[model samples]
Target: MLRLSKKTDYALMAMKHLALHGDRGASSAREIAEQYDIPAELMAKVLQRLVRRGLLLSHQGTRGGYQLARPATLMSVADVIQAVDGPLTVTACSTDDHACDQYTKCSVRDPLWRIKDRILTALAACTLAEIVDDTSVPTIPVTLSRRTPAPVTER
Candidate 1:
């Protein structure tokens, strides 16, 4: 199954936290980690990676921490995922041509490529701002419909 790495998850959470508290000024990695119950060391590393990727700005010394390098609305989910986990790949052969042994004989390669592209487009369309803002919406109610089973007849 396709899934995002834990690092990516942490990165997204951190970004959302920063965006929410942006007006309060920068936040330390420890503060974010503590608020979310994440490991401080791991959060620190994640924040550092984001800074290196140019998605976050780091401030040093007392009362200093990290902040978003750009507006959250300008940053997509794909950007955070990519920054933490590199490129997104649905299949082994999606990235490198030699990644799969059946590279030369793969019949579904084109279809897989198209699927990957669509998935990326969807991810790119969603921004951190949209996600953070969505928190205020009421949860949709889910209703399950019950269906009666058909009687089995002997042939």
Candidate 2:
């Protein structure tokens, strides 16, 4: 199934929180965790990973915590997910050959690879700034209608 891991979800949440706050300087992981009802320790781990990935800047002293390493406009959802999850791969064969035994004779591999590429491309095209900017965010193109189709008139 196509899905983001929990760590990636938390990382995005954390980044969004920072983006919304802007240059309020650093914020404690505890504060972010509490605000979002996320586990503080898990958030710390996710934040540390982000720091290592250079997406986040962390400070250790008193009045210290974490902040965005760059403006939200410069970051993409793919970057955040990659920072936490290492890479966005929908299939084992695409990410690591050892993870799947059917890497060689899989007839469906090519189509699955294309689907993964499309998903990654869409994710890469979306920036944190685009998400933070309410008016610019794209809406999901889905519609639910309850009306029955009108009966055809006899000619």
Candidate 3:
């Protein structure tokens, strides 16, 4: 049942968009929203969260829009998710000091927290640069044949 919030999803999408089209300068939330058919209001809010987190920089002008605060390679998915959503957790006790009544007796709590930490680390390893690079290796890449070239192609 673990899943990312809608706002986090939007934030990641916005970051990727900015990284890809950053050469064109900033991109208004409205433009990105329209491109992806996301609600303009929601997109604006998600982008604002990123700006507040210092993952993005907002501009104010006739052509005002948003841009990445740093290179995409420097921005981690975990950072963007944490900005939109407080933090990633697999259980209620992952971040809360006060746990459920069973907290003390729960045998699985510790293991679950470990899982959450690993997940977080994995997310941090992925950067906006990787997401926007659509040229990633194909799902099924062509491989070299093992057969020799027919005994040096005798005439």
Model 3: weakest 10-residue lDDT segment is: 133-142
lDDT of 3 by residue, 26-117 (tens): 99999999999999999999998889999999999988899999999898888998998887878877545755888778899888989889
Q: Which parts of model 2 have CA positions greater than 4 angstroms off?
A: 95-101, 140-155
Task: List residue ranges in candidate 3 displaced over 4 A.
Answer: 134-155
TM-score of 2: 0.83
Give per-residue CA lDDT, model 2, range 23-128, as digits (tens). 7779999999999999999999999999999999998888899999998988999999999987777666764464566766688888988888888888888899
Candidate 1: pairs in clash: none
Q: Please list the residue runs of candidate 1 whose C-alpha ends up more than 4 Å from where it truly belongs after superposition.
A: 135-155
TM-score of each: 0.84, 0.83, 0.84
On a 0 to 100 scale, what is the lDDT of residue 117 in model 3?
Answer: 90
lDDT of all the models against the reference? 0.90, 0.88, 0.87
Better of 1 and 3 by lDDT: 1
Residue 60 lDDT, candidate 2, scale 0-100: 89
Screening candidate 2 with a backbone cut-off below 3 angstroms (N, C-alpha, C), the clashing residue pairs are: none
